[model samples]
Target: MYLLELYQNNYSKDLVLFETLEEGREFVAQIPGYTLETEDGFDVEYVNPKYLPDYMEIVFNGNIVPLSRFSFNSEENVDIIWKEISNLSVKNDKVIEGYSKIDAYVVNNDEVKAYVEAREANYRKAKDFIERCGYEADRSFFGSEDGEAILYRKCGAEDWHFLCHLDPLFVEIEDVEEYVKEALEEAF
Candidate 1:
């Protein structure tokens, strides 16, 4: 995928995101005067801080001069055109920016029951609380049939999970008594 960035006489901006260079070249050929360029992929953030690309244009005489580029018929007109191009924009793949594992945490069905039974409401708060207590509570994907997914990473093991699934919301824990125990010994 490529970003077909439009420019008119080195002034103005517009973006026509395309899935391939051929698509971009087609758009350029149709609008004679408008110069097209490529930009690196953008992040998934929809509200991009970058300036909007150059506006649309039409080729004037054989050698076009002076920047009298075209404008959208109306805001609706712009919206309609953007509606077509926006989806074509290359969005960054979902990424796990960072990762942390709860190797030293504990989980008991009774203790984390506060989360499991009424799982919906308390999940967020409980998850946040667990993270603040210095452990990533996870249960589901990495879980086993005999047990819920409580991620207890072995000391110095290379099997750390992606930060996305390493959070407390997806897992359960119990033992309300010793929440975030200090100086708990770890077994590799």
Candidate 2:
């Protein structure tokens, strides 16, 4: 029962209120609007400025859900990949370049199926496998910067949690193969 404010027309100050984050996201998807940030695909602001003092009222289109609701080991996967990359002694330039390629694919405008095919060919694994392995973690895409890097935590359990953005970059490639293998071994 989260509250979300959606701005339909920025210039006109027209807005719509939603009881759930999903409803706000759906409305935004159906209608085009400008956002104030870039992390969650879009940024939705609050119509009233006083409700949340000292915080800008905005939503990250990518992270509106409570992480406790989902079960995925996203952080572990990222750490595993990071350790693998580190163990391989991968050059910083190579890491940056590799991540850039993944970012490009993520930001691409092509159809989802085409992207999946291309990604799979590049990674040598099916898209479903990647997702199943906790790489492509589930997210709400609420539309805020502070809410961008939310990690999922189990409901009523503070210790068990994982980050959502662990896919694509976690898989090792080329020079980082040995590290990837080690990480995969530990992952299993």
* Candidate 2 similarity to native, TM-score: 0.22
- TM-score, candidate 1, is 0.20
Best by TM-score: 2
Clashes (candidate 1): 11
Q: Taking the tens digit of each residue's C-alpha lDDT, what string does model 2 give over 49-136?
A: 2222232223445544321201222222100001001223543443221122233234332344454554444344322333444444
Per-candidate total of colliding backbone pairs: 11, 14
Using Cα atoms with residue i matched to residue i, what is each candidate's TM-score against the true structure? 0.20, 0.22
Residue 170 alpha-carbon offset, candidate 1, angstroms: 14
CA displacement after TM-score superposition, residue 80 of candidate 1 (Å) = 67
Q: After superposition, how far is residue 54 of candidate 1 from its true place, in Å?
A: 88
Q: How close to the true structure is residue 29 of candidate 2, measured as C-alpha lDDT?
A: 43
How many clashes (backbone atoms < 3 Å, residues ≥3 apart in a chain or on different chains) does model 2 have? 14
